[model samples]
Target: MVDDLVPIFALMIPIVAILSALVVRPWLRLKERQMQASSAATAEKAAQYAAQTERLEQRVRVLERIITDRGIAVADEIDRLRDDRTTDPRPLN
Candidate 1:
């Protein structure tokens, strides 16, 4: 009975090892692929954010140029009027 069990145990060890190797090998490969895909997606989103930031920066520069051309004193007056509108507590009847 001991001899019979010894051969079965030896066979099972190799089989279990092979099965685990087979499963883990493919799982690792799939995980690597997922990582690569996620990295690409992240890079794409970063590029889009960079482009949006650049456009916003350009708009700010244009606004600054216009304000400077018009003069700070005039711009301040306009800002004061805008603030007045927001601060007015009176309801429009």
Candidate 2:
């Protein structure tokens, strides 16, 4: 009986290994794809946030320049911008 069981156990090992692999492989692949997709979405959001930050920084710089300047320079810059008809009227993105 022991001799007979040895061969059965040996056969069971390979069968169990193959069955576990078949079951786990698809789950691992799905998890990997989900992680990749999540990473891509995070990267996209980060890029958008970076762009928004840069735009805000530029606007803040322009505002600071206007506020720190003397009265005549500040007025001149506003007038110049108003007179530049070819430029886009909306500065904020």
Candidate 3:
């Protein structure tokens, strides 16, 4: 009986190897495609964030220039605008 069981066990090894090959290969391919799609979405989001950051940086640079140039006053101008609003409640044309 033991001698008969040896052949069965030996036969099962190749069968198991073939079954796993059929199953694992397709599963690996599916995972690879999923990873590629995820990476593409991430790259798109990164590009959008970079563009938004650049626009914000440009606005900040413009503000800094206005503040540094002699033509603009921060606090006094704000007060003047506030006074104008109170004196003339009408919207400018």
Candidate 4:
């Protein structure tokens, strides 16, 4: 009886492989698409962070110029910037 089952088992291996292939290929494609979308979102976030960083750096440069230049009244410029910010509640970018 066990010997009779050997041929059956041998045949089952290829059938199982074919069935699993049919199921797994679609799953793998779905996973690959999900990863691609995730990476694209991450890249978009990185670009946004980079732009924010650039904007902050520009603001820092402006502050440095204000503080270092002797001709401009630093206190008045600072007050003016504060007033501008309150009047136009928008990001410098």
> How far does residue 26 in candidate 1 sit from its true spot (Å)?
0.3
Model 4: residues with Cα > 4 Å off, grouped in runs: 75-93
- Please give, for residues 1-93, the per-residue lDDT of candidate 2 as tens digits: 799999999999999999989998989999999999999999999999999999999999988887887668888888998888557676765
Q: Give the lDDT of residue 60 in candidate 3.
A: 100
**By descending TM-score, how would the candidates be arranged?**
3, 4, 2, 1
Candidate 4 least-lDDT 10 residues: 69-78
**Per-residue lDDT of model 3, residues 1-93, tens digit only:** 999999999999999999989999899999999999999999999999999999999999998887788454776798898998889967788
Which tens-of-lDDT digit does each residue in 1-93 have in candidate 1? 898899899999999999989998999999999999999999999999999999999999998888888887877989999999999999977
Off-target runs (Cα >4 Å) in candidate 1 are 1-12, 72-93
- Candidate 2 global TM-score: 0.66
- The residue pairs that clash in candidate 1, if any, are none
TM-score of each: 0.63, 0.66, 0.80, 0.72
| Best of the two (1, 3) by lDDT | 1
Q: Which clashing pairs does model 4 show? A: none
After superposition, the stretches of candidate 3 with alpha carbons farther than 4 Å from their true spots are 90-93
lDDT of 4 by residue, 1-93 (tens): 999999999999999999989999899999999999999999999999999999999999987886888446877877899898889966878
- Give each model's whole-structure lDDT: 0.94, 0.90, 0.92, 0.92
